[model samples]
Target: MAGHAGLTTHVLDTARGRPAAGVRVELFAVEGGERRRVAGAVTNADGRTDAPLIERGSLTPGTFELTFHVAPYFEGFEAAPAVPFLDLVTLRFTVSDASGHYHVPLVMTPWSYSTYRGS
Candidate 1:
């Protein structure tokens, strides 16, 4: 895995105890003191990104943010109420080590969310 450089992310819907499919994920890097979008992907049925957040041979050590657009997802589902608590959720962290696996997992709900580094 070290030889194949890349970054990955996953989102689990704690409210439903399942993968948060069709959730939009945006990857941004803090470059020159500015946040820039480097990549974007949508969560699949397994709550995992359809592709690596950052592709191989493109990984770099820097501060990064993965913004998950969840509000629209909840609003689209009639089962969920029209008014959701969270509009946009962003997880900011550093990719200090580029050679290793970085798994960012998010467990979220309409009212709250949680995330952590996973293997």
Candidate 2:
């Protein structure tokens, strides 16, 4: 995990125009048609996990999922929709190269969300 050769993520709260602090995020490895928990962390004040969800040495070429607890994160906010449009937001992707860095950043609101590969 030296240099930029692991997996990282960032969460942004579009409604608040800031990082989605303290939000729970989970990483899962998909194998044999089943998903198994790999690692998990809560976003810090900057909406980033303290370390790469997957370290360089631990990463392997495979399919993975990053789940963001969207509804729960917005529960404390007053403007959150009463029923919230999205509960858990899961992004599934494949890693063909274990030594390459993967940056998955989420831009979200109570009603909508978007994710993209980042540098």
Candidate 3:
């Protein structure tokens, strides 16, 4: 992972079959039982980060958390007749190895969401 090692993420609006644009994402690192914000950005038109969440040279083996704000994204959707059940979605995972690619893809709707390791 020396060349281009980093963390990346994407969100697919399963309900709409499209990228989740304008979603707010926050990256945090766990330290001594406390969470610290490392970096953050909003998803682009394609629902992918414009830059890697964590760059290669800055990567470390540890636990990380990604919080995605999904409330506003579903507020006006016709399918969301009521307030969304999930407002702030958080995904916590570990980076045991920093030399490999880590792609976290989230499939989500106004009421629920799921994620997994992606290629």
Candidate 4:
């Protein structure tokens, strides 16, 4: 990892059976009725960001969202539709422990996506 440990994410393009590179990822902090941008990064060749999206000391106990720009990625591919079934794939999760490391990964295709807590 290139960043201080806190929160991380990985993305896989199941449709092509490869790591999703150049995908945009955004992190948001959800506070009550308002959502604020915390951090953002693009995936590398390995389907992972160069740094932790939320660095260690910056994380707190609250709700957060990781939105992946999927539609644009598939647009350049030959098999994807002009208007894909999925565009922005957002994962909303809560962090109850600021001291803990959270790794959330997405395995996705044009029409489907799945995610879970990662090691």
Best candidate, lDDT? 2
Give the per-residue lDDT digits (tens) of candidate 4, residues 4-25.
4489999999889999999999
Candidate 3 all-Cα RMSD: 1.2
The TM-score obtained by model 1 is 0.88
TM-score for each candidate, following the candidate numbering: 0.88, 0.94, 0.94, 0.92
Better of 3 and 4 by TM-score: 3
- For candidate 2, the 10 contiguous residues with the lowest summed lDDT are 1-10
Candidates ranked, most accurate by TM-score first: 3, 2, 4, 1
Model 3, span 1-119: residue lDDT tens: 45767899999999999999999999999978899999999999999999999987678999999999999888989888576788999999999888887888788988789999886
User: After superposing candidate 1, which stretches have Cα over 4 Å from the reference?
Assistant: 1-5, 76-81
Q: Candidate 1 residues 1-119, lDDT tens each?
A: 68656788888887777888989999899877799998998899999997888877678898998999999878766566788878889988988778877778889888888888887
Summed over model 1, clashes come to 0
Per-residue alpha-carbon lDDT of candidate 2 for residues 3-89, written as tens digits (9 for 90 to 100): 788899999999989999988999999999999999999999999999999886777899999999989889867888888789999
TM-score of 2: 0.94
Q: What is the lDDT of residue 35 in candidate 1?
A: 95
Error of 2 at 20 (Å): 0.4
**Residue range with the least summed lDDT across 10 consecutive positions in model 3:** 1-10
RMSD of each: 1.8, 1.5, 1.2, 2.5
Clashing pairs in 4: none
List lDDT for all candidates, in order: 0.85, 0.92, 0.90, 0.90
